[model samples]
Target: MKNLFIPHFIYWSLFMTSKENYHKVSILLSIYKVEDYLEECLDSLLNQSYHNLEIVCVDNGSPDNCGKILQKYAKKDSRIKIVTLKENRMLCGGRNAGLDHATGDFVCFVDPDDWVEKDHIKAMVDAILTKKDSLGNPYNLVLNRNAVSFMILADGSLKKMYDFGETSGEKTLNDVNLNVREDTEVPMWGRLYRKSFLDAHPDIRFLEGMNTDNIPYTFKLLAHMKRFYVIKGEENATYWRRLITPEGAITPVVLWKNMEIPICFDNLFDYLKKHHLAKNLRIPYHWFFTICFPRHKDQPRYYLRFKELMKKMEDTVKSSDVYKQEDRNLCDLLLYAPDFFNFMERYFTPVPVRISRSRIKLFGFIPFWYIRHKERKVYYDLFKIPLFKRVKTDDKEILYLFHFLPIWTRQTDRQ
Candidate 1:
């Protein structure tokens, strides 16, 4: 039984007197077998524009040289705190251990393998400190831009970056904001959390040994927030993530846990119900059926397990009173005839096309005009102005408005 201790009281006593540390941000880095990338990750935090950062790295019993690397960094920088464990506790357990020693007013989780921009902490802290929810209370969460995953190719050149975190929208997240997939509903990283708020809700801890922990943790956290703030445009900092390839998507252990998402979701719903929290599950319902299950539905090795677990999750989703009949109907459609649902979702789904003056270019790169039909009328716009007059026909098909770019624009129907 190898034991390691953190002298938290002495450290806090020395730092608490400084007013500059009032808005201190504690970054929790859960280190396991990431020695190769650990130094770069630590360097990124050390170079952060936010000087008031507290970097808490938990060496989760990593057998590699991660412990040595953490110690090396800690000796050079007082802001770096090290927590060691005897064995691997997985991501959630490691972060939980880090949280116990975190003394920052705001907390953020950064993977030891991933690095962030220099201004990431500064951007997050600045927004969270100055902003407040509708009720004039500070938000429990502050979301930054989506993380882009990058990888180095054989030639030492970077591969094309792919964006993760399927969400976007308003500056402040509300009920409607959550309806569309937007940032911070998932992924523990790329966001900032208030330590005091987290302390208030003891039930919000991450479920150890769970691959799908972030989903339920995020959902429950959102319920307590009056609203959360999203940093948009240039002001927001970017989280540069390293692309990770799964060893095997359908490995026995991975498959078993993948199938356990429903159980995790069930446990989440139970917790929500027990505490009487608002149970808006739009994200969870769609994410499970549409995203999680569908990914494994096509793999032959995992199809049977996927179907069985999907049906179980469907039951949990159906029991929730917050969902409407249409939502339940969709869930049934997905479970019974996934092929038909996929076809409909691919072709019949209403995908909004956003057009604005700023997007149009005169060099013919982006079309200066857009045309669509509606009820025997052809609505068209050129450079955001009506160029054609309305034409009526005796017999014509009624079509819905398809193009929406409102900028001093007029609609004219033409036969």
Candidate 2:
């Protein structure tokens, strides 16, 4: 019997030729059970103004009608390429499959539930074609703004846009002011990348796990990237549809693990240290140990692992010329948490603890309170807002007065 699968060399050559001929961006759509929104997503891609485009949609064995939708689009549009997995491969596997089949010089991964603006590809491609790095290579990663808004089917309309402005940038990971924790940095979508950069880092494959498929993969990619472009403007593109369906991948347990919590910091620190990227690792390590840790009291291991991680983090920071007094202060706070040594032992134990709902809710609010009290200046500066920026109008006051006013008066007003 003849083998059905094409050789990798043949595939690569075909892809390269296609890239040379089209000189377009490849949109990688990883579809699972997003049948409810698949058509709309595909429509957005089909309607893109960027003519030289290839849409590679990988269906990871969705039990829903998503496969059928993908097939329909593939049949209708020659540019739409569909790859249906025989078995259910999660997000990471699906994306890898799409990556394997993508043919454009630049690749953008879009969730099946999400749709991009008409100019998404044009913006990114223009930036990549025009912009060059210090080493003369085109910018490896081009980040488009992600507007978080819900698309309501009732009126077939979207709500007001919640602008997450220039969230990803070269300085984002390294900035002292931007205390970006691991959990916040690994979002897989909203960025366009060069195909060659990804090809160079084949080992940067997404982890085929429940929670953290993107963190390890993104970290490895970012470590090697030279130039990162941030596109800024009012051209609102990429509508991230927030589904209310409970059946989606995210769950409370999944969230705990996927948040990359402190464990990711440990893993990333090891990775960076192994690669001798010590200076680059310091800020992220400090943020992970200090900021991301204290927020979760329910994760006993976080508390237990505190002392050792703190020591390592302190040493790493101290050894670096970029280390600051604020970083040291943050470390001190972690070391001083109630029953510091014992907490470290219990919290860092290999075994996981059963987190109560009440504890989860309490732990959830801790970050906000901690930022307000401990790192007030850092928090304000990172958010690019002034502390005690008063509400201007009566309507605005009614909205935010409780956040600023004294507790008694706020309670009385609410009552």
Candidate 3:
């Protein structure tokens, strides 16, 4: 009456079956000085729904407790691969080191300071491998198409997601908002890469020391990759970039701390030219920078940078293989001179609202408050804060070997 034999057979069957279908994934995480958030990041990776993961975490020689925490996790989970460097190689080099250690069929990048959704890897690997029998599309890359950013206040508590709004499905190269939104979002991470494709296109690595490294990586994927399989909705594949952490992040614009867009574009032009792809990507490539013009035109040194930006873009467009003369002229005008209607956007752009920590936690929705500056122009910097939203989500395929707040399941603590 106990029926012990049936249960024994089922247990053995599952054990044997799971062993038979192990598709390994290599997670490449680049670490610098992420001591505060390192534990959360590792927990998410080590406890993914997919058990067959080889996490290659490279500590770019962080001076804090980051390396120690990583070593602790590595000891606990044999799946974790740790690489320690004596000197910080910034983000790109650190990732390269991890890439060198990757041995999985598919590869993914995760910043050590960030956390992902519970089903993030499971969903991404599913999208990349597609139906399994065929090993997915094998050629094109797969993306979650959306990512979330969380600002860790000075006190180490989060104020929820940064209300950038959300759009589902693939943000294709052809989409008009691709440049604008993708740049704001962590465009590089949140996607799974097929090892075969990356191996073949090995040169498509992140540009070391380049501020706009994503441009080259993204452009290469756009030009060379076969197609995209975008994962969205219930199968959410996204990362939470912990902005305003202990060390904080560099602000973009107004004073132009690192306005390297044009410099990066120059490199792009040269790369496309060397590879003979310049002719075809002229307009689309040019649109990459101009899409953010209206938003950036109100900054302190807007005109200073905007002038150089136009000059560089114009050069690339002129040298491009094919383009209508009229189109080129229009491109020059938009690049060289903004019309009155567009120029006046400086006044009406709501002075680049910088919602303080209190403002964000207090308000349930995104607020628009105009500010008055002492300067004559009275303009606000557009890139001050990220546009993100607060949403409630549940955990998936809970393989949570380690339960940690800020690791996929923790709900936003926004007031």
Candidate 4:
């Protein structure tokens, strides 16, 4: 009855509208039989200082207590939303269910088994908001640099993925090009994306049932995005990625993880070819052939599968109007003579020699220089960790090994 003035109504409307300019980040958490870890992951999100969050945890019909756990969290916090399915739908389906209920300015995902640093969301939201496009709009996507991978040791100790020391800042599509061209990080998490951007590209969904789904989706997402930035999480808190899994969560034994790898490349290759991106996706091919696929030579059967895959890719490239023999020399080598590329991969990425337990008793570390693999034994001889593609910086050749002992130089000696 009092203060019926139109101005009063206008004032409240403006206040509510102004708040929307800031973010309300939606976190999509997909779970299946992750009861032991779900609550911990949820706590990490709800406790975030970036309070304007809507965490949608989809229990993809877990036959465990995961659904009940999520429901309990929802009762405590209105910010936490629970979606329970009646059947298992795997990763893609679980994600899609969460997507249906997402109502936020930006979105990111956290697996049930993973947790985050206290200020993880705050850091990501702050950095993303700090960047603007040429049109003065906020950046559409942001990458996280300070994420850590945690693995539990036999003695129950925790191991971190990367130690944060250096101060890094915001990145543009230009910055990503330099790294993306050289096989950069591609995990789905540890980043922020505008919800609107995802809505615009319906086809950008994760590859269903593919072991290396991220492999294609990550590359394609970068190629599709026009504006992006990187949040400098290195100096701040970061997401803690869980590298170990419980028994039920064990990695499925993959068949070639799909020998149809070249077929995987076909879609992206076609996209690049269609858009006159001949020069753009070469490093992508390099990433798979040299960086990703080299390690799977664990079995001679793998080599045969790769041979057929390369043959298909070679035929596609040779028959196409885009890819060239010069640019795709690696693929071309495997296509023309699969044995030669196999020989080179064997020669270059020679496995760490397996010495007698007596040798281990004598020396703490085996000097790789003494490991000269020859003849049919070369097929079985391989690096315990599949070696990274040799990268040449300035005048030096760098061979990246396992994450723990990352760099192995191929010079006369190593200091």
Candidate 5:
């Protein structure tokens, strides 16, 4: 009788192990008041070719018909699990809620407003399972696909793939010889991630009061991953609906809020430095100073805060060998905009610059008119060259010349 009981227990344990290994992907969705587009999003997810998916939907107090829709889907599909929050939590909160409930080998976050290709999950899973790295460890892949470009009306089905090889703004889906970059970092929705990686880095949570910007969280997540996969093929996956209309989904104005952006940037910079990633952090740091910092000038307190933040960044970059030159150049450009800088200096010292706008404008237009004179030059100079090459070399001179073209032509056109 003892021998019989031992074999029975062994048999049951082996059965449970087999069952656990069968499930592959978990689709983690964070839903709010997206009733208009939620059905399409659900439909795309439900129809994925990879059937071993567990759907975890977190509803953050949607006052719309979203609750009913989620309930209906949950009832129909046993795989769909719904978690309704008591109060309206923000984007980060909703995602964390979903993360807590997820129990799959791999995870993908899909915004309720966006839809994915039928084979999106299948392609991503295949890449992760089959692909091997230099050390023979399975590649911890983050798979990204192109987004469709239709905002309000779902009728205009636009499918465009990102060609990483083409220059930042120039690459379109139509280009045949597009040289795509292998290691481009993009927003969260475009990719599928390994769940184990996320489990290892529990501290990588999204900022609650932030404008739902995924870059900070996504970058931190990707930095920890070993390999990145950019899937470019007939897969034609992930439709990112561009809301073109004024009344469509508006990006949150937290950047314009007093002290929000500077604090966020400062936090991100410190995180990078602590992790010994200050060099890679320069691009986003420069971007924040150039774009978001200027918007705060409308408010006095925020404007002063922006100057202090800039000074702090300037000092930090100066002290580190990784960011000194790039930071100096960016600081020079900010100083050149006197009216803007003058407003900023109310709380800090103004960095001085001698060049006037008129002289800068003159040299700027020459390259602009010259490049636009032919399509080849436009393609080669504007799109073909990598961003680092342009940022580091004579490309600034080219950029300066291009800047003047608009002002020069504006005068000509007015005449």
Candidate 6:
């Protein structure tokens, strides 16, 4: 009777716990030459408040002691699973290997050189489970804030010197608009993804054999997402990203590799076109035009292959209905302006006039007093004057400006 009861109890426990109630989050880490920091990274995940986690680490032929360290952790905690590769396959290849091995209800990424707060996994899991879109669908992605850390030689430790913003509260968002906005952060870390959603779109894997491979991969995810959730300042689940290391200093720019920027853009463009989601071109095209296209002239082959690619991009932007008239004019200067002027003027120019417009609002509404000014370069300060002016206030006046001369104006408490 005791033996029969044991089997029945095990079956009952399994039936009681449903996948929806308890989600298994797989934290994927690609192990490379991070032996010095590997232990701290592993410990952070192992100590996470969230218990149901699969820590998948891909040993991408690290010449350092990372492999041995991983083995040591795996023995202590069965949650740490390791996948060994014969040779170094770069970041894309290593992450792809981990993604293939991960078996969890939700998926996330972490850099072996970086570490997360103890509640990182738990915070993300709670937000994703409780939050739903307008249509009552679960969020496919969730983004959080992270801290940028720098190494300090005084104690040979990482110090958090900077914090990223835009994560104040929980909110539902449209991902395409977020991607198009210049302020949005695109790094894969500090985010959570639904495993089933990723499995449904198998082609969204990172493109291998390229530097800075996340551009195309992330753009694809943003374009396809129906809606995503963002939870800020929750349980201090910040991803601490180490910017400087002893041996891993930043690399110098390579012209040939820079050429891949357009290739990445085109890859995203073609994907959207093939799927009949060409309307989403605004996401990639915005970055290509504003950020990537301006730097193309620096390439030595600007006249050869790069020029042709720019023309193709210009045509695509011209044909798209997503851009406003201002964007089209900027593209015109990019393609038609002389190379030297375009390079210096576009790159070195301060904030354009359009972005510097100022307005006075009263309690976040229209103000009683108004002043209109014209735009001009700093060199032409003498010629600068108000384009128009309007005043509609009952307050006592102290002084005011009529055209270029001051006639009367007022000092008010509200002002």
Once superposed on the true structure, which residue ranges of model 4 sit more than 4 Å away at CA?
1-22, 133-137, 163-167, 170-178, 181-186, 211-213, 233-235, 245-263, 273-279, 291-294, 297-327, 338-415
Off by over 4 Å in 5: 1-23, 133-136, 153-185, 235-246, 250-261, 293-305, 319-324, 331-415
Candidate 4 Cα deviation (angstroms), residue 69: 0.7
lDDT per model vs. reference: 0.67, 0.62, 0.61, 0.63, 0.59, 0.67
> Model 2, range 309-346, lDDT digits (tens) per residue?
66667677667765677676556656665675655664
> RMSDs, each prediction?
13.6, 15.4, 20.4, 13.7, 13.4, 9.8
lDDT of 1: 0.67
Residues 187-270 of candidate 4: C-alpha lDDT, one tens digit per residue: 666777888888887676655544344445556666666556655544666778875533333332222344435555655656
TM-score of candidate 5 relative to the true fold: 0.65
Worst 10 residues of 1 by lDDT: 247-256
Off by over 4 Å in 2: 1-22, 134-137, 151-161, 166-173, 176-186, 235-241, 244-254, 257-259, 282-298, 302-314, 321-415
Clashing pairs in 6: 399-408, 399-409, 400-407, 400-408, 400-409
The TM-score measured for candidate 6 stands at 0.72
Measured on C-alpha atoms, candidate 2 has an lDDT of 0.62
lDDT of 1 at 233: 63
- Show where candidate 6 strays beyond 4 Å: 1-22, 146-159, 168-186, 234-236, 246-257, 284-309, 319-330, 338-415
- Model 3 clashing residue pairs (backbone): 129-136, 162-388, 163-387, 163-388, 163-389, 164-387, 164-388, 164-389
Model 5 residue 175 CA deviation (Å) reads 22
Question: Largest TM-score belongs to which candidate?
Answer: 6
Q: Clashes in model 1: which pairs?
A: 167-181, 167-182, 168-182, 375-399, 378-414
